[model samples]
Target: MKFRRKHYTDDTLLALYKAILKPRLIEEKMLILLRQNRISKWFSGIGQEAIAVGSTMALQEDEYILPLHRNLGVFTVRNCPLHQLFAQFQGKPTGFTKGRDRSFHFGTQEHHIIGMISHLNAQLPVADGIALADMLANRNKVTLAYSGDGGTSEGDFHEALNVAAVWNLPVIFLIENNGYGLSTPNNEQYKCEYLVSRGAGYGMKAVQIDGNNVLEVYDTIVQLSAQMRENPHPVLVEALTFRMRGHEEASGTKYVPQVLLDKWSALDPVSNYEKFLLQEGILTEAVIAEIRALIKEEINVGLEKAFLDKMPEADTKQELQDMYKPFVQTAHAPANATKTEKRYIDAISDALRESMLAYPNLVLMGQDIAEYGGVFKITDGFVKQFGKERVRNTPLCESAIIGAALGLSINGYKAMVEMQFADFVSCGFNQIVNNLAKSYYRWGQHADVVIRMPTGAGTAAGPFHSQSNEAWFFHTPGLKIVYPSNPYDAKGLLNAAIEDPNPVMYFEHKSLYRSVAAAIPDSYYTVPIGKAVLTAIGEDLTIITYGMGVHWCLEILAKHPEIHADLIDLRTLLPWDKETVAASVKKTGKVLVVHEDCLTGGIGGEIAAWVAEHCFTSLDAPVMREGSLDTAVPFAPTLEQNFLPKYRIEEKIKKLLAF
Candidate 1:
């Protein structure tokens, strides 16, 4: 489909001139604020204003933009309130992030603009996911994702491009080749002749343009965007410009040569655009002065109002809870009175199947999740039942899977991401901890995603395949961690996680896949998150455990009934049932925390510390903790058994009883 080229009228020229001027003025104000110590740092887009303004102008109002820290012109072109921008840089309460973040790190949901983190290329997969959602919904919207030439070196950039190409997503990957990534020159960044040439390798249309030429950049993006809206194919646009300023205000460009700086300075995008407008006779001297005076007055007025705004209060307990709030589905009883005894793995499958049946917007993505039904057969027959579009088999790219799921969630789809093994979660740790975990706190965006991690040892799957990595995410805030032991809780917690608004790491222990079976309700129901279930109640002691540890504790209790103890299954590790644990601890006056993860930084230490601090007066003994030795999970069964065995737990119980 051929799109009519956009005609640049006097109004268009004036708009472009204003768009270029606004960001320059804003950057100048920010640098002033930085020198005055009113703002902490400033990332000036002084020289590359044309790319932000031109590309954004080409996009439809409803289209989404995932911008980088230096793309101030995108904000101005999108009409982001000047006062809010000032307030954000000033760290005032009226800022978009409520002063939680500063400078180009906040987004407005209403505007469909995603805030960015310092890890530059992370947004690429998210943009792909957003475009995927639009494609799935049959919408004409396209997504424009921005990155620096330096960010192209990241693995996420390649993964995102591959997924977008394979799926034919309507996403425009805009790489601002600003000659330098901080102090690193383009020569050191990549071996490619042109960054846009890499797009052909990914099976997408590609283009390289003089980024300083606003008219050319705007025309190229407008034509490509028009085609993408109908055909739904990814496009790569490499905008070649230069970073005229230091990386940030404080980082002086002393390392840059004087000759190169002078060469680029003469061709400054803002100044060149003004000159173009004058040559075209689109603007008179009086009109140019009017535009400058108007923008300066606007900036000054916004800064003054922002200065008067209050700072965020220090009381953050409630704020934290509000930021991490999960989506809750309406309560409903099971459809029938019938119950079925299902194994842990089968129950997980049932929960996913039922969830998809209920929520049309729910999508499952992972390696071999669709056609193969996952390696564990947990998603068996889902592709045939729900179609391949919903049950997707992603490339062996963990970072892209999790990052795209975050994007899907933001676009109003509930995404269920699967890690082939719990240990492999390390591959996507940056996205999980940095992007998914911090998105809500940094910007009020809900990542309604459920990450299914088939976890644990006992089967001796070795270090690469078998690991209880829950402790890694447990340390990160703005994430919900659910590790259910039995089939009943497995189905219910998985269902709850799918319904949640925040990102949830749902761990299904591989050891319990076929070994454990229980009667689960036939209809939909949710097990409340952050709640612990009491398998056994006793007055002598309380055993706090989750996942595989829950079964071990139950076995110990069954073997020695005389050892009166409360066996509590902490189904949710994060926001762990503190109330339930405190009540049990106060009654028993003795507590033991157990898990299969290694000892040093295991969640066992956190539980023990909590008991020591909160239940100190009631304690009859020091809080005992049991876990694997602080080393990589051994490959040999003999070593693994000695590391975390039922006998070791029993021995600890005997010592606690004697104490």
Candidate 2:
């Protein structure tokens, strides 16, 4: 087959030949290992090597690249040590994330190659945020985000493109069209003739390229990257490549026809590029053979090193440390005020409104927040007070909503993003875990964003509408998790969260939103971000809780003043106030942990275990825990009251008193 070639240089051809050989050898060895049962599974970027290499070469060393799962070629070209990549694939301790992250989530910011998120299309908006950061910082570094054609079908993709284009961020959304997303083929993935056309609707610069042709891929990226740098607008570069292997290790080519594979195989990018290199006089047949042998040898060494790498230690103690990294000590508040007054929702609103006034850079955005004052009315009158620019309403795209907020914060604006309910936050979890949590630690990219979601049960909204998912964020590092149970702490802790340099997941119990009210102080203040507050001081026993549980425990204390129960409300769960908790438990000589989340791996378990380990000497009896049952929060009001942790605080307090 004859292929048309345009202006091409010797260096470009040589680069292509090098790029294609590296991944091809790795894939070849991976297949061999898979057949020999040396590894469980493998996914090869065999057919798509050219696009990764060509596009990456167009980028500056300081620019960022977000690769997808099948982006080994990009990783290899960017000097991501092959041994580390394979170790990550093997789930070894020497992996980039110290084996805490999965294989695809591997990257070193030192190489300006940001990690990839396994979820499709999730990286697009994050790329926009990173690019926006560069633009605001007056840096010329662009961010190139790669995803599959199927990813274009996700709402995140459209939302990200729209925001990036509208803001004119310097980002390139590279969609490698390998024709199938798992078992679903391109025909099923979209009705639109092509994915890049979606960008036109969003007013972004879009182009389609023959991804298998290294020359075409490089030339096209050279043009797009240069244009994006100058204009500082986002563009979509759809690289039409072919996935020669199965979707993953477990998947087989049975779902796809052999004929199609043969057809795409005929256009083998490595062989095509090898021919191009020789034809351009950039390489002789001897040089190509030598390069292939060198790449294979390099792959063999990396594979051997990976096999010899140590497995990650599965010790819970080590895991705990890994889970709670980036922890900072926060000063606890003074003795509980003799007078306590305020409603949790009112306190939250005050915190947001006051923070906006105090910090000009602090902006608040959400759906129906500007006029409707939020579905829960938490931000009532905020828009009127802060103006449209500062307190704006966004479209009904949850993924985009948080994505844009992240982008804003990355650009030096402290953004408070409110998801109507915690349940809906699943739409933006990819952005939260993959992008927001890791950005700062990965590339020194700070994301000072606050994500407020009303979580927990007792609303009787059923599984989809009501849930407590603090554990999700708690499991992720580089994020602060705060769950305040009262009005005073809500207002104070929220102020601190907004000011903090890291991303924070502020979980307000949905059941506490307006169900009860208290008198919140009018003065602007900040409560420490990772500290607990002692609601009631006593000596007989200690009751630990947060969010709704704090109020419930306080109510129990009010009814039984003679019980001598000490109540500690954990205002922040991530950097939890261990000092305050331990001191209280030591004084009481007995302790009970309470929370509204599920019993299994609930935040309370961690607290109870910690107290057991650290405060066991002072304990007169076994430490107790109270949390919602293992079952899901039911929709029925009566069942919800039983399934939820509304009454667990009282029950636990009674048990402690009896002990």
Q: Which candidate leads in TM-score?
A: 1
Give the winner by lDDT: 1
In model 2, state the lDDT of residue 45. Answer: 84
Query: Which parts of model 1 are misplaced by more than 4 Å?
Result: 1-6, 326-331
Question: What tens-digit string does per-residue lDDT give for candidate 2 at 265-300?
Answer: 999988876776667577897887798888888888
**Compared with the true structure, what per-residue lDDT tens digits does model 1 show for residues 130-151?**
9989988999989999989999
Instruction: Note each model's CA RMSD in angstroms.
Output: 2.3, 5.2
Q: Model 1 TM-score?
A: 0.97
